[model samples]
Target: YGGIFTPTEAAGVGVMAMLAIAITQGALNWTQLKDSLLQTADTSAMIFAIILGSEVFDAFLARSQLPMKAAEWVSATGLPPFGVMALLMLFYILLGAVMDELAMILLTLPVFFPIVAALDFGLPPEETAIWFGILVLIVVGIGLTCPPIGLNVFVVSAIARDVPITAIYRGVLPFVAADIMRLALVTAFPVIALLLVRLLD
Candidate 1:
């Protein structure tokens, strides 16, 4: 690979290149550009709002030492490693019903990360962290597609006003099922998550 740009910088360069191409092809008109800018602003505002809310919640939890207490309590319970992991996954599924993925992860990582890291997963510390992260993302994806309070469903419903929310939820059932299967595989065999990292190394 050329050392001209870091990965992050490459993303910016790619965006610039796309913009140049669009402009050269007369595909980027003033009205479309204005709409794109407006949409980007709206999305950025929403993301920052989520981050702000999660950070405030995280700060409160830190001040209360709740995560530490919870970790201590879990350790004292004498549950097997897999048993505790199961409970945490269940908790995430329930919590994800109400919170977005980012908020769920940020607010709970303080408590959950330590507990998982302390467990003997037959892998190195870094590998365990990576495996747990993949599992968390899978569960969060499942939660986002579940009925009732699924944040992504709500977002899509807002965009496609003509479609019933129930229909959208139904459409996503296969995806959720697939994610659950992926979660099960990753949970049972951490290697699936770490193989690429190992290969790269």
Candidate 2:
């Protein structure tokens, strides 16, 4: 039988194997590893900047009391479990149309999460939070590929200005449909998002 190792041990072993492979390929050198680490550091730094920027606005939203009011309104509605979920998805989708996904999640989740937790969704609060988060992410994904203001679509167009945005949108339509199907399944079942959480036990 094959034996397993701790993740740290496996990663150490993998790094050693990578060094051996690079040596075999005639590319192993202190300079090459240093360059790779520098590149990784640059990428990580860019990501950290965005996270920090979003957190700044996220903190403001919590301090304003608006999120708590929204949560209160949601709880007062007494909507059915599925209806409550649908409303949350729609709310996130419409918000995604104008707001950045990271900022919206960081800000709105604090408000909306309390509302969700108060409901009797036949699931634990933690599971409801995770499930709702997955739906919110799916909704924001549409904005990533949408035209007029899609950041990803704009990035693609900037690189190839000759190609019309229409073409890109058309090209991405099928993928959007696939995404919708994935969202529907996850929304309907909820288990898709919770499998790992369930499995860890």
lDDT of 1 by residue, 1-201 (tens): 488999989888998999889989999998998998897777666656654654675567557876466657777889998888877777677656666777677767877898899899788999889889888988888886776666677677655668997899998888877877887787888889899999997
Each prediction's TM-score versus the true structure = 0.68, 0.61
Off by over 4 Å in 2: 1-77
Q: Looking at model 1, report the run of 10 residues with the lowest lDDT sum.
A: 46-55
List candidate 1 segments past 4 Å from native: 1-77
lDDT per prediction? 0.77, 0.71
Residue pairs with clashing backbones, model 2:
none
RMSD of 1: 4.3
